[model samples]
Target: MYSMRMFLLFCVLCLMSSTGYSQLPGPPGPKGDPVNDGQHGAAGQLGPAGSPGRPRIPGLSGPAGPPGSAIFCGRGVSGQELETLKNSLAKLELVVNYDFVRRVGQKYFVSYKKRESFSRAVEFCSQRGLELALPQNEEENNILSQFFGDVYKTAWINVNTNKAEGNFEADMKNRPLTFTKWGEGQPDKSIQYTGCTMLSENAFWRVTQECFLNAYIICQM
Candidate 1:
């Protein structure tokens, strides 16, 4: 029993000497570099992942995206747009005092006033230094036709048969002093001695009123 006890004690002492007493000298501190400080280190650890390597932030955000491209629309006009443009010209008046006005397509439409003999109409136009009646184009004739239609009459075309008895001639030549905006089917020779003229919408011209009737007329510049 005493020998056994002695052997156990010896074994314990050896184990203590091997483990507890032996101090491993820190790895030969690299020549001039220290171990504890990260100089040559194994002792200075990788420091707990260092807050995930500061999250590798991208350097400076790329330049701003290019400006958004513009879009394309259309060109043609229709409906109200068309009507609006047409009305703009039709209703336009360079001089507000002028009453007879309308749109003869591209041109401004107008006519003479009412209650004037053919001769008086011409004289009035001339005194104002204007042609008694001037039709700019076929469109103007048609537009004036519309006005006569509203009144149901034929119109004088500033022309007449007031020459050499039953003859027709020019205003300066055998032409009358004034004229009418005569519509279609006008001045029927049915009146025998009446060889006169007037205006109407539904061909009002044939009604043969006295020549001295006062009326308006278009002044030509």
Candidate 2:
């Protein structure tokens, strides 16, 4: 009976120690062996393309594309290119085509045998980087007039005298007429709004028609 009482006392003491008082944490255990790294997972399939985002401050515009090689009126084509043009026209079966090019002094002329309206002729020559021929002086005027021979009684030249009765200017050079070959009392202002000049069969020039009349074209380059 005494032993049993002693055992009871000892149990009570242990329960007090566990429940009534806080115990300190035990020392850390030695680290265990490291585990091998897991295998890398396969790359997931690319996510579906994201929806297009609204442009924020529009992305900088790309540089402008280079201009097309088509020739325009500003700067004349190089000699080599002109020669190439001449050759190409020569091979073409076009009647009185660009092959009928003539070089007088420093200027180049292309006379088309086919007659066209003043505006149409300008467009034709302009598309090819040429401008309607202009007579610089009496000499140029006579030469241009004679170039066409008697084929057409009249041919178109780049003479626009609209604003002023006698104020005429060349299309290509944009210069006033220092020398004119008006055939006695020419430029009959009573008829047309915009004067269209023509090289007469007599090798004289006169503003005889409106812009609509079809006449031989002579372009200068």
Candidate 3:
């Protein structure tokens, strides 16, 4: 019986030792190799476009610009200079159109070959910035007579009685005549219709009722 009990106690002791040894933690295993980074993934698809922004407001206007230069065609020309140019051009045109026949003092006389009525003669001279020939004195009359010579038998003068019977006046300015060389029986007050005057034979002034009588005209400037 004693041997059997001692054998039993030894068996119990061996079992407890085995259990304690199994329960003890063992030394850590060798450290694992560090993990390598994963390869990069492919890029994703692009997203949808965003909506448009609001419209912008307009700004205020700028100030006015500077004045223009007076220089024209590479030359400085003012308003007066332009007027002078126009006058020169008009004089040039007159020279081209009219025949310069005679000149007395500062006045120049020009004539047209075609005959016209007294009214038409006045208009013609007026359009050219001139007036119908009016003899202010005997000297001007003689000059005009010599100018007429044999070229024109009769010519319209600037004297007329259109305002009063036998009361001759300068047609242009309606002023009284300072000089008169009336032919005999001319400007007869009895002949009330004879209003306009003309230059006839010997440079004498004569009145006629025929205002439409076509006669040569002399223009003075």
Candidate 4:
């Protein structure tokens, strides 16, 4: 019985030793379930400002190339269309402040209500591709007079008599005033330095020294 008891004790001791040594942690148990996310880190300090970039260089233009294709140069509107426009001046837009334009024969007359000096009137008309109105015949002069006789008593005409005392000339064509429609007592030499002519209320041509006179101007082309 003594020997059997000793053998049983020895077996128990061996079993306990083997279990302790074999445990070891078992490869960490497959990494738990993954921890919660961590907070974000602070931003780093900004770097120093950089130097300005170099300016862009404009490239030199290349040599002139061959001549381009030829293009037709002619009037944009047809004769019929031009006639329609002339007859219907109120429909066409000649310029600002000119609501209606008059068409006599082949000429176009655009009247301006704003007053300006005769020289200024010429300049204004020239800038708009026109010149001061020059009535070619008695009929034209009478028509113009009738149109503005009541509205404006006197307006600047394209005639200038600076060359000679009684020798009047149309500044437009630089031709002598063949058909003179002088008022009852017109062409007085009182004021001949202004170099401008006026169409009196009676449609008569008169010489005035008031070139700086601000009167309505009629431009024609």
Best by lDDT: 3
Q: lDDT per model, in order?
A: 0.52, 0.71, 0.78, 0.72
Number of clashing pairs per prediction, in order: 41, 0, 0, 0
TM accuracy, model 1 = 0.38
Give stretches of model 3 more than 4 Å off. 1-89, 149-151, 161-166
Model 3 Cα shift for residue 210 (angstroms): 1.2
TM-score per candidate, in order? 0.38, 0.51, 0.56, 0.53
lDDT winner between 3 and 4, please give it.
3
Q: Which residue runs does candidate 1 get wrong by more than 4 Å?
A: 1-96, 102-114, 134-138, 148-155, 163-166, 169-186, 190-196, 203-209
Checking candidate 4 for backbone clashes, the offending pairs are none
lDDT of 1 by residue, 79-192 (tens): 677677666654453325466766544555455445466677677667743455545455555565565534334444455444344333234345343434434554454544
Off by over 4 Å in 4: 1-97, 149-151, 190-194
Model 3 lDDT on a 0 to 1 scale = 0.78
Q: Model 3 over residues 188-211: C-alpha lDDT tens digits? A: 566554467888759898888788
- Model 2 stretches with alpha carbons more than 4 Å out: 1-97, 149-151, 169-174
Q: Give, for candidate 3, the lowest lDDT window spanning 10 residues.
A: 163-172
In model 3, the clashing pairs are none
- CA displacement after TM-score superposition, residue 150 of candidate 2 (Å): 4.4
Candidate number with the higher lDDT (1 or 2)? 2
